[model samples]
Target: MLKKPTSAYVHIPFCTQICYYCDFSKVFIKNQPVDDYLEALIREIKAYEIRDLRTLYIGGGTPTAITARQLDYLLSHLTEQINLDMLEEFTIEANPGDLTEDKIAVLKDSAVNRVSLGVQTFNDRHLKQIGRSHNEAQIYSTIDSLKTAGFHNISIDLIYALPRQTMADVEENVKKALALDIPHLSLYSLILEHHTVFMNKMRRGKLNLPTEDLEAEMFEYIIQQMEANGFEHYEISNFTKPGFESRHNLMYWDNDEYFGCGAGASGYINGMRYRNRGPIQHYLKAIRETNHARLSEEVLTKNEQMEEEFFLGLRKKSGVSVKRFEQKFGLSFDDQYGQVVKELRAEGLLSEDKDFIRMTKKGLFLGDTVAEKFILG
Candidate 1:
């Protein structure tokens, strides 16, 4: 049996309302199978060997949206393997509305020490446009409630580049965020994914996003505002107060192995990668019959993993150390990706330090193009 995940990700696929831009595995129903899902999730957890587990992230369609009884069932079971007192970080994704005082109490009483709130935007018009259920009042109430509940480590999420979003709107959102004085902020651009309603709206000419230049301006604006608020741009789309960066997210960007359970979750271990089934009923059926849930599996080739590592590492501002890359791959970075690395450097997209290679601000802006350059295929 595989040892306990060094990190564990639990997927709570139930959401009250699906956001227009969401592409995650989620179920929206008037009444759903939260209990059955928990049972299968417990079976999946018990299927794994518990060892060296250090982090836990309960993300979702909206985890806090689940009934408190469902949460109690899940947390009680997960605590069997995870040492809450010693776990480096345990994060739970919550929406501003879902995190009522009672829900906040449940989390605080549990091993969960961090809250990643989906406070997408403070503007009510924008929130309505994006199909978010929360408002500005809920944002303040959520933050205040969490802080009152002694959750000092809180991270709020924000999105810029919304349909018809203006620079002033972006600036105003930043101001509201700064007013909270939270420790962490994850600001992302509104991405129109293929399967999402937002994309369909665009296809039907109902949605009009900002131009590339405006989007870039929003990106730069977020960086400036967050920095001015004493937050570090440690990773793309992530900013944090000093000494409060998210450890679990860092593990992913560093390409460290982790164990994941719950429907549609993914796991990475000893060079094998697999994702669980997306459908809730199918995953439950699989878990009931086999005691494990899985949908697809792949073993990464050495070069493929390298491309992934570089791309993931470059998401960090500190960048990837050449020595570390070589240590992992058993080949010098220069010897393997030398030509492409040089071209990127020549084009002023990447820079080399004494022991590391990282994207510059320009390359960071064009991360899609820069990532493609590192691909060996």
Candidate 2:
């Protein structure tokens, strides 16, 4: 039997404005059916048997874009289903400008204990260039507001290697981030996803991103700076103080199943991974008609499962546990990937200790390359 998921992800696909690099299922919250969408989202959540959840992450295009009343309604209905006291962490992603005092108060009244702000850069120029609505001032104000409201378990995201971003820019961004004294940080390199404005600009030679070596240097700089600031590099792109690591994200890196609710949300349950409809109308229609909005589902084979375990588990700083792998698959980790591991080790990408096999710093940079070696097919 598949283990019951203790974590859940809710997607809010509305944003005040779309960023140039974002490709997530999101729409401008102008004339959209916000009330209908919220009702449909609740309907979809009710379809599942309500149980105590360990982590509840409400991510988005921007969850904070909704009005205070809307946020209260959403959280109230959510807590009714998933017992609030049982949640180890309840996170809501917010954009700096969108997080008004009223909305923060709504969050304060709810079970939310963590707030992750998408403060992609501290440079107002870069922020504007990237199509972000908020400026540096707003980011500081939002952080201040969140802290004043007794929300200390706060995290912020920073993106490096943006178009025309320099080493100086990255340093400035890091310095500003560290000064915030936040508990957690998620630093990511810019990835030009298909359908994003950045990608279109790149095709037209209009976007000048950092070179691979410079990008790697920026990554290295972030790791060093975060470590110096007393943050642990718990995951590839995540850093945290000792106990402030995001438990909700840890659920994903651990390859644990989770319920994914809302438009375009993805969930893993009963050994099957499924995605909900992306279009708001379609999602609403599905939820209204069938009480579920699943668009597609895929059941993994044994080989697929093993590959996922390796790839996902290795993303953690602790790497994959030999005992856990053997117990789960009833096969020796060495027997299955002995040659691959040996090669990676010889290349100085992997190292094995008593119970865990982990990636080295060099391997972490080439993470995708290392992970792809484990694909069975």
Candidate 3:
């Protein structure tokens, strides 16, 4: 049997307003059976019999979109049984305007120690273009409130190379983000997903996104600015101060298993990966009838598992360990992937030392292309 995972993730699929770029399973929080959903979600979690967790993340549509009482109820029952003393980090995702004072109090009293705000940009006009309800002012006010409330371990998400966005705009965003004095920042290039407004616009030639070369330039600029400001480029998309790396997210990059709960959530356990029902009613009905909401699962083969280790591990600046790969898979790393690594290093895309095989500066730019070469298939 596989060892029990020490991490857990819960999803809350209700947003007050939807973004043009978001395709996550979520609904507008109006007239949905939210109370019933919450009760059913808690019931499903209880069925897992989770006793202790080192990290727990409540991500969303918007966890803060719910009422203060519901937030308290969810937080309370979620941790009431788990050993709070052993829970290292509990994070919840919030929007800038959604974190009301009452909800803040609820979070402060709970075991939650970190908050990730969806402050997509500091540009107010772009905020509207992206269908975000919160403006630039609310972003500052919300951070000020969070800091005043003694929640220093805060992080924000920023999207660059947006529609009609310029290099100067990104610079301003970086400058403003640094001014906030927060410890972590996630910068991503805007991606148009299927079934989203941006995709449709792109089909009709209505969307004006940055060119591929410009996007790459913006990424390089972001890396330089973050490093110059004392933030470590710990992961491809994440920057952090010395001790403020996101432990919950690191669990994912480390390719460790974790329990996923709530609607549209996916979990991996005992060598099987499962996804819960996406629609709220389906998820609720599954929990009501079977005490679980899993819809489908897959058992990965050894080759697939090894591929995943390289695919996910290479995202970190520290890259993959040769010894760890051998120990985990009972196979020779150099014998299995030595030729591939040799070719990548010849292309100036990888660097290997005695311990770890890390991406070179060029390799980090073409990360996906480099990792695809390691697929055993």
Error of 2 at 340 (Å): 1.2
Cα lDDT of model 2 by residue, 1-377, tens digit: 54678899999999999999999999999999999999998888888875779999999989999999999999999998987678899999999989999999999999999999999999999999999999999999999999999999999999999999999999999999999989999999998999999999999999999999999999999999999889999999999999999999988978888999999999999889999999999998999899999999999898998888878988899998889889988997878998999999999999999999889999999998999899998
lDDT of 3 at 157: 99
Residue pairs with colliding backbones in model 3 are none
Q: What TM-score should be assigned to candidate 3?
A: 0.99
Residue-level lDDT for 77 in candidate 1: 83
Error of 2 at 96 (Å): 0.4
How far does residue 232 in candidate 2 sit from its true spot (Å)?
Answer: 0.8
- Runs in model 3 with CA error above 4 Å? none
Task: Report the C-alpha displacement of residue 327, candidate 3, in angstroms.
Answer: 1.4
Which run of 10 residues does model 1 get worst, by summed lDDT? 45-54
Candidate 1 per-residue lDDT, tens place, 80-104, comes to 7665566888899989888766677
Question: lDDT per residue, candidate 3, 1-377, as tens digits?
Answer: 55888899999999999899999989999998889988998898889887689999999989999999999999999988688988999999999999989999999889899999999899999999999999999999999989888899999999998999999999999999999999999998898899999999999999999999999999999999999999999999999999999999998887889999999999998888899999998999899999999999999998988898989999998899899999989999878999999999999999998899989989999989999998987
Q: Candidate 1, residue 72: CA error in Å? A: 1.6
- Candidate 2: residue 172 lDDT (0-100): 95
lDDT score for residue 135 of model 3:
94
For candidate 1, the TM-score is 0.97
Backbone clashes, each candidate: 1, 0, 0
